[model samples]
Target: MSAPAAPASRADWPEIRTGIAADVHAFAVDDPGPLRLADLDWAGAPRLSGHSDGDAALHAICDALLSAAGLGDMGEHFGVDRPEHAGRRSADFLAATLRMVRDAGWSVMHVAVQVVTRRPRIAPRRREAEARLTELVGAPVSFAATTTDGLGALGEGDGLLAQAVATLVRPGDPARPA
Candidate 1:
């Protein structure tokens, strides 16, 4: 919820900006099922995802980048019903988002993402998650892990939530190159 720092005025320092995007999925619970967040190795936990290939991490990051670029959100760009994305890798969505931003004359500074869950403890997969995300944006990005801490419906462990922030370098900045 922190405000994005001024971009044009803070040229000396990397211009700071914040964009938020969130998503939730009603993952059908099943033991020995596929856990579909980046094809992640789930360490033998319950599976929860609504999409054909349920990837909470990729979905959240896609929205973040689109929001930061002042582009319409995910639904506006990628339709959930489209056959192109059917059984598609969530990573592909993130890659497409990067192409959109670059075409708009901007370079990615970094992205920060949060994956929310109450089971199986996601801390172990944090590094692998970030590496994959960084590749999506074509730059270094941050992926952080946090739990609902038993605070809300998510805290009670009903579903999962992912939130992300994307910072972009505007086009034509002398100090930045796309």
Candidate 2:
């Protein structure tokens, strides 16, 4: 075979200061009762249980973004016992998260989320879910789904789990080396 191409140097990469955060959230369906999975928006899908809409995906995403910006977590900002957030929607959470991140001098660059569930197959509506989340966050959002292969509670179809990673960047910050 011909010689392999050399890897690009660090200088070749874009000059930007970026931060990353990841979070995971899992809830048993029986804990909080039947609540909707906001992203899926499918009527037949098994609902999650939580104080809000219980969209694990959105909640995880918000947590990740907040963590990345050193802004604490979802529970601290929107506590379970807070009556004001009793029946809030995941979309509202997302909006508030974006605003908080912006106020902290960071902008969301990208978001990726993976949800694990055994019901209402995600492939059919994956695109719709991604688009909706993107609109809410004003950033590109990627969505994925998986099953536990009958291994654990998720595998046994008891609940859903979601994990998210967020990339944030601070622009025009002199502290960041160009």
Candidate 3:
């Protein structure tokens, strides 16, 4: 191999920024209904609680994207304390973040997320989550599912964890999206 490929020239690539985020929240255990719950899950399944849909994964991913783009965190824009967003959709928040990212002179090149749960395994709905992220980021989004393996508070049965990474691209020539 004569020098392999030397990777690619950054001079030709758009400027990019990246950020990481992680979060965990306790399960509701109070909601009456079940969502895709099955016996294969941990001993018990508790509903998640939050102002929005309570999807820690989505929330964390959105925060990562906003942070990478220099936008404010979720609470500053849509916090539980604000009654106006008492029951809004988390997707909306991500969408707003996407717009803000673009407005702030950046584009979401990609995002990756991991949703950790002992019960109601995340493997099943991972694709759906990726699709939702794609819609917001205006590009391909990747997702992964993992378990604490009885290692953390989440594994101990207190709650779940959501971690995310967002990679943003600064336009090479400030081209507008069509």
Candidate 4:
């Protein structure tokens, strides 16, 4: 029998002339005992624990952006084991992720983040959070807050959770090397 034709590689496929990519990510962090600092800055609020500042919202956004760009998740890019990332601010992570995405030939279109927690009500800081994220990503960012209705770890006031979606666009032809 004659040899079968091999499937075409991505390089041989038709180029994407123009379009946008989107992705979503969810993350949660528990209290790191009584000593660690939390990412959210609200008095009397329990902190989310992690090697970094543990801002669930920013972590989710970074993961979403990386996913939208076909890049690895946050853990791979910035693992807890990496001493350099220790105690790093969430804003710094967001900035670094944005730079990586741009280097990969994509631009941010928008970002939306939703936080779930029983403590540290986000409503009061919604505008400030959105403004800060927007400034970091250099694009419009939306913030939403919700509670788990006294049902989960968050409801129990043990931690915070966040979910985010990011839209990215490739301005030029995709076939061209980034």
- CA lDDT of each candidate? 0.72, 0.75, 0.71, 0.70
Candidate closer to the true structure by TM-score (higher is better), 1 or 4: 1
Model 4, position 79: C-alpha lDDT score? 89
Of 2 and 4, the candidate ahead on lDDT is 2
- State the TM-score for model 1: 0.79
The order of the candidates by TM-score, greatest first, is 2, 1, 3, 4
Index of the highest-lDDT prediction: 2
Local accuracy of candidate 4 as per-residue lDDT tens digits, 1-178: 9997743454443322222222222223345333211134665564556677777777888888888888888889898889999978877887888889899888888888887777677787788878877877788988888898999666787776777888887744446553
lDDT of 1 by residue, 1-178 (tens): 9998655544444444557888776556764576776446575555666544667767877888888778888777777777676767777777788898789767788777777878657678778877876766677877776786799888887778877777787644556542
lDDT accuracy of residue 112 in candidate 3: 84
lDDT by residue (tens digit), candidate 2, 1-178 = 9997642554343333333444333444445345455354565554566788778888988888888888888889999889899868887888898899999888788988888878757888889889988888889999899998989877877777877888887645344444
Q: What TM-score goes with each of the models? A: 0.79, 0.80, 0.78, 0.75
Off by over 4 Å in 2: 1-35, 38-40, 175-178
Q: Candidate 3 — which residues are off by over 4 angstroms?
A: 1-13, 33-44, 173-178
- Stronger candidate by TM-score (2 vs 3): 2
Decide which is better by lDDT, 1 or 3: 1
Q: List the residue pairs that clash in candidate 1.
A: 27-49
Q: Rank the candidates by lDDT, best first.
A: 2, 1, 3, 4
Best by TM-score: 2
